[model samples]
Target: MHALDYFNARLEATISPMDYVKAKQMSPEKYFLIDVRNGPTHVRSVTIKDANVIPEQELQSRLNEIPQDKEIIVYCWDVWCNTAAKVAKFLLEHGYKVKELTGGIAAWKEMNFPVTNSDQGNNIPDNCGC
Candidate 1:
């Protein structure tokens, strides 16, 4: 494939943080967001509002909990983290339409996007340390 086509194909399967927000706003039920970070890190950090917390290690067993009807959007701690990619690939192999969240929660937080557990007592660390 040509370089542009290769990159375009790759980009077609991912969603940026802002675009996710817009899509969610436009059609809340069209997408199912999953946070694939480990249990410990996820507990310590605030997650995107309404995103299902499914640790990557437990995903295969919890596959039934994910809705096949909706597009699956997966994210991990940050863009550098590959857990979301692994989960996305797994979901795709099982016939679910999947898109990875570019930059994950790190980018969401960086953009100041809203998250669950945002109470004053909630301590979202600067780094996930995953």
Candidate 2:
């Protein structure tokens, strides 16, 4: 099977960028946004507003930091990146409700969603320079 097929077969929880936006707008409290990128990449790139940074390498050990009640939505750099899927799989196997964000942060920006960076302003540029 191809990588996409494998991912599709193995994962059931996923949220589209538009759907995520709607959820955030309709009820921001319903889910928790998690960025699974490493620290360096996270620092260089823009992230969704209010997203929690839990690098994929540390996610297993840091599972305790995530709340059990809320749905967890994970994202990485982009659709090609598998980190988000891996994190979502780990969370699902661990009995936490989870969803991988389709296309990751890049897709979010492509859809004109809001993002922030420490060095940059509140709204991330459309190009992102990622």
Q: What lDDT would each prediction earn against the true structure?
A: 0.82, 0.78
lDDT of 1 by residue, 11-114 (tens): 88899999999999999889999987764543535878888877777678889999989999999878778888888888999999999999988899899998
The lDDT leader among the candidates is 1
In candidate 2, residue 104 scores what lDDT?
89
lDDT of 2 by residue, 83-130 (tens): 788888888899989998988888888988888774422232233222
Against the true structure, candidate 1 has what lDDT? 0.82
Pairs clashing within candidate 2: none
Q: In order, what is each prediction's RMSD in angstroms? A: 4.5, 6.3
